[model samples]
Target: MAEDLHEIVARALMLDRSAITDDLKYNSIPEWDSVAHMALIAELEAAYDVMLDTDDIVAMSSVGTIREILKKYDVEA
Candidate 1:
């Protein structure tokens, strides 16, 4: 599941697979800024087929947090 999450984040943020780590946070990666945040959200929605709430969007801060947020929507990642 982490691997799949990594793929989505990497593709959305235009990052290499190695760059994704458990400690990775939204703004920690330069490319994971506002613009890419929206893109990442779009990618996740498309990939997982779930629409995230605005609260969840704002609450997503790190890879771990992302996993938790997705779980709220019944996403296994």
Candidate 2:
């Protein structure tokens, strides 16, 4: 799951894999705006095979926050 998350962040946010960090935040940079956020969510749902609830979607503020959300679904990434 972490691998998938990494790829999603890299691709959707246009960040290199080496640039990925736990602090990756939506709109924190130009690449993380609404379009990228949508792309990231789509990528994540496809990879994790679970739909995100509204609250989870709202709470997905950063990579660190994403980890916490995924944990609720029993996904360690």
Q: Give lDDT tens digits, candidate 1, residues 1-77.
A: 33399888889999998888757998876899989999999999999989989999999898889988888888888
lDDT tens readout by residue for model 2, 1-77: 25667777798777898888898787788888887888888888877787889889888999889988988988877
User: How close to the true structure is residue 73 of candidate 2, measured as C-alpha lDDT?
Assistant: 88
Where is model 1 more than 4 Å wrong at Cα? 1-3
Query: Which candidate tops TM-score?
Result: 1
Q: List the residue pairs that clash in candidate 2.
A: none
Off by over 4 Å in 2: 1-4
> How much lDDT does each candidate structure score?
0.88, 0.83
Alpha-carbon RMSD of each model: 1.8, 1.6
How high a TM-score does candidate 2 get? Answer: 0.88
